[model samples]
Target chain A: MRPVFLIVLALISQASLADSPPLERQQALLELLHQDCGSCHGMTLQGGLGPALLPSALEGKSALMLTATILQGRPGTAMPPWSSLLTQQEAEWLVTQLKQPAPPQDANRH
Target chain B: MRNQNLNNFRYFLVCLMATVFLVSLPRAPLADVRGTGDLGLVVERTSGSLTAINSTTRRAVGKITGLGDLSHASLVYSPDERYAFVFGRDGALTKVDVLENKIVKRVEQAHNSVGGAISQDGRLIATSNYDPGGVRVFSADTLEKVADIKAEYGDGQLAKVVGLVDAPGQKFVFSLFEAGEIWTADLHDPKNPKIQKFKAGKEPYDALISPEGRYYIAGLFGEDGLALLDLWNSDAGIRKIVPEYAKNDPKLPVFKMPHLEGRALVGDYWFLPAVGHHEMLVIDRREWKVVRRIPLDGQPVFVIPRPDERQIWVNFALPDNDKLQVIDTRDLSVVQRLTPGKAVLHMEFTPKGQEVWVSARDDDQVLVYDTETFREMARIPAEKPSGIFFTARAHRLGL
Candidate 1:
């Protein structure tokens, strides 16, 4: 029983290590950001009441440069600092995802 | 040279740390491009502006604003079809010229105004508010607050008082709201009016009085049935819940909750939806019981009865597959299902009964449908337009 327990624990740790977001999961996250965040911001990430979060929105800012803006946040503006809610790693991942161009329109677009 | 080398090494360390930080930080901010253009126009309840739809077709028509602090506004067109009275959401009242599309006058906030009502004679424009537990009477012509009659009720009770129907003779105004109670106030003297309260339901929202003014039926949102009220009986228990129809139907989306805000008196029967039961509660006025529960497609919100009382117009409010479910009350069967909008809220029939005006809140526009054919007639752009009433009789009543 002790030997089996040790094996199960090892397997669990390995599984968790491989739990990085897949393409579909990343797309879903992007969709939520677009839907929920786009309400206040322009759909294309053009400036509205909120500062744009897209590549065109940020004018091709580097990942590190964007991280500084998100971590410190714009004071006296609606853009709240995300450092509290997001980890450094998660912010880095988000910045990497935003760097990609939006997909072309499809026939089944909702 | 050794000290200079040491300084260069320190600078190299700093650069490495910065590079690590850049590589580790998230490269993207969330891209929320989805929810921006869902609803065309949003009526800012806190702000007093009627937002126009961002479309060329809508912009070509026009935009009107400057009605003050209008909260949860219910609208009604004048009898002569010249003007519209907006029962502003915040209890302020405003009148608008329908053709010119401009606000004529603005009235200040009254009690907790939820529903807007015009008297039969159109001489009195009365609206009910929930918080202060009173109704404000306004002169339709002058847009003046003529009177405020606070009804007597138990202390520490918060009654919403949503539904108001002025009796045919215009002698009394009957209304029901949050606490499931019915009220009758004498309107002969608008100022210092006499008010009476009756235990109507466990929770009531919208009500319809019989044309003859002998009986009143209210949709109880809390109790999930219709509450019958006897107008003439002073000591008689006027409140009776329809037993057979009160239970929620498991089949429909509006199943078994209790009540929603739609009721209409058609022919000798009152057709309404149970809040939880996706079925329409058909009350046989003659029998005073829920004789039948007509099952429907989704959570029914508004019921538009034809002037001829032959057809019943019902709209489901679900965001997905939201459509206008038309029930021919004559047979209690769904004759047609038309997708009016994404989500429908309230509707009113033109006095001529030729056209039906439905407020598609999800789409931020009012859809007009021909009564006879149920075909799309025209669309009126509105801001979160929900409540509707008519003005033809209103002009005659001087309201």
Candidate 2:
């Protein structure tokens, strides 16, 4: 029964990932994560007023947990929640990008 | 004898080249550049320094350097509009000669500061500081320190000052960020000013005196309301308005502090950015009531109306920072939506309301638009330009 539950959970997560926003919207969200998020988290995500978002900094941190934090900002801090601007699935996708090796090319392009 | 002749010939050739080089130079001499401040313009490069442009010709005049930490710098023009007082993020107050495109005098008044205000009489300049938590007044001409009044609140704790502006009666008004109080200092006696104080809202981020210099409204960060003061009637005390604004509603976290200057008064109603929400809260200025809430593309950052009050333009915080919304004053509705490139930091309308200039930070360009046609007219390249200020701003009160 436990094995079956694990399989169902894996399938649900896959379905959510497949529901990612259209290419155009996904692209815009990536820009927001880099520039807007960079305003506090640092342009390069190495950390300034906010904590670093680099993969190295996010190493021991779980992707799901970071997604929750992105959707619901930490209270009593300057880190604002992006849930109003981003969908939960989109937030999850962004967390994945945040843990990637490098920021998107156009993030710094303009 | 032959070698001497050769040396003289070489010297003659060198002098000819030197004369040609000096003659080829284009910009006017420092002495000649004086008194042309009316023709001057400055675009603050967040990186550092200012690129001086001829406001009349729309051409880059020259670059003025050695200004420290321009990341959050603000400017105030002199009475003749011949000079600019630049308040740097590092608390450096620099008096720049607009005509000569040079910094005349610079003094590090505080460890850190946000911005400053010039006295109405143009006799003094005051800076609102973050570090050491106080304000310092200096003489406009000599750049000499006049007074250092600490923003002290309960239990002798010093507080950072914000929303500083010059009142009509030779007084400087500012609010304390930490202590949550408003204070006024009369510069009648420059060395020792008579200070007046009042308790205001919690975490008042910034304040703006009305265009007519009647009301001083400060938006709070710690709470959901504003502190309003009538300059004409100081004894009336500071009253709280827009109470419980977005308090019960599930809202997003405030990413950036909305400026005090963006509250646009379209006749009777003021369209202000609703903190942490995708809406511009409309309040009837007479009753101080939240009469309406106009939905926006994102968190509204800057709210500026045309000089004629025909249209009100707004920019947002993030993700939607690329979009701009314009509201018609006649019907009080969004008239146009503009995508002027990414990270639009600031905008300024023409003196006569012909065009509005917007700074696209990421693109490093100043996008100009024809207000009537609502069309992009020109794009002038700049170096990380954030603020595009006209000398005309000097004429306005509590600007």
Taken over the whole model, the C-alpha lDDT of each candidate is 0.57, 0.78
DockQ for all models: 0.01, 0.16
Candidate 2 Cα misplacement greater than 4 A, ranges: A1-72, A76-78, A82-110, B1-45, B247-250
Each candidate's B-chain TM-score, in sequence, is 0.72, 0.89
Q: After superposition, how far is residue A100 of candidate 2 from its true place, in Å?
A: 18
Tens digit of per-residue lDDT, candidate 2, span B318-372: 7688889998878778889999988887888767778888878778787888888
Highest DockQ scorer: 2
Q: Model 1 — TM-score against the truth?
A: 0.60
Candidate maximizing lDDT:
2
